[model samples]
Target: MALLLLAQIASGDSGRVELIAHPEVGAQLLTRDTTRAIFAMRQRTWPDGQAVRVFVLANEHEDHVRFVKERLAVYPHQLQLAWDRVVFSGTGQAPTRVTSPTEMRERVATTPGSLGYLATEHLDERVQVITME
Candidate 1:
């Protein structure tokens, strides 16, 4: 079962997503752990110490599920549970949720200190891609 899960994860679905940040973020690369931390709301600042603002598609969104599983190596349910625990315990807040990829691009582009994932084709000059280090 574990190997099967690993294989499935190793072969994520057809779509490709990119980690995108506001142009002002000034970060060209981030380690997988750091990227996960930011998305998990566990790390609140970038290496440069700017506050990190996280964005996400709705929990049920296909891209959200794919990115969480493929990039973060976890199921969407796990991420949701973590967010719920933090929110209920009053230690952190849930990420801003956008309904569509278009909204995601707009929000991440206009919001400072923002980070989110988008299908590669949705990426544009308004935001820069953060390569996994």
Candidate 2:
């Protein structure tokens, strides 16, 4: 089961969806643990004290969402439920969902405090790939 799951994660679906940030941004925003921390709402601010902005793909395409969810043992419905609760409680906002990986990358690269994911093939010098721990 572990091997199968690993294979699923390694297989290229829509392509490799990677966490990305602007070049000027440091490694503080990159890493599997950090990604998990952000998604889990542990680390709310960047090392520089800027509010962290999060971006998510609109759906479960390319298995990226599943990767994160399973890797973190985060259930999809639970995540949605948490988001709904946060929304109603007026706590924090859910991630801004984008239509495509390109859109995610573009938005994250251009917007300050933004962090997002994209296919590895689409990554360029303008964006820095965040490493998974």
Candidate 3:
């Protein structure tokens, strides 16, 4: 794990970005595709049928851009378009946006079934890390 993190850093991937979830969230592991779908707001519930609450930072934020690109394998613009389409078409709602990483951490920690990304340095026992495959 240390080697992989080092490699990501060496490759200019600010690997500090991590997928975090509310402590009460049931999921501990998820496939990359499922994670993308959740972030894209296509999957409204977890595999176990629990409702999902997705949170995000502003699209143009560096961590947001990096998390979209490096983790979800999508561009920030594309993710925005997806959210816009759903919201405009009245199908789904966009993820709640937090103003800063501090708010992201706070919201994710307090909201059940919530998921968001944050830098590792901001992590605390209040939230759980959701590992992606």
lDDT, each prediction: 0.85, 0.65, 0.88
**lDDT tens digits, residues 38-58, model 3?**
999999998788899999999
The candidate maximizing TM-score is: 3
Evaluated against the true structure, the overall lDDT of model 1 is 0.85
Please give each candidate's TM-score.
0.87, 0.73, 0.88
Runs in model 1 deviating more than 4 A are 1-14
What does candidate 2's lDDT look like per residue over 1-133, in tens digits? 2343355357753355566776666664355666776765557777788887877775466545664664445665665666677667887777787887678778888877777766656666667766666
Tell me the alpha-carbon RMSD of every candidate: 7.6, 6.3, 3.4
In terms of lDDT, which candidate is stronger, 2 or 3?
A: 3
Kindly report which residue pairs in candidate 3 clash with one another: none
Better candidate number, 1 or 2, judged by lDDT: 1
lDDT of 1 at 35: 90
Residue 120 shift from truth in candidate 3, angstroms: 0.8
lDDT digits (tens) for residues 1-133 of candidate 1: 2343344347772257778899999788999898988888899998889999999999899889988988888889888988898899999998999989999999999999999998765766788878887
In order of listing, the candidates' clash counts read: 0, 1, 0
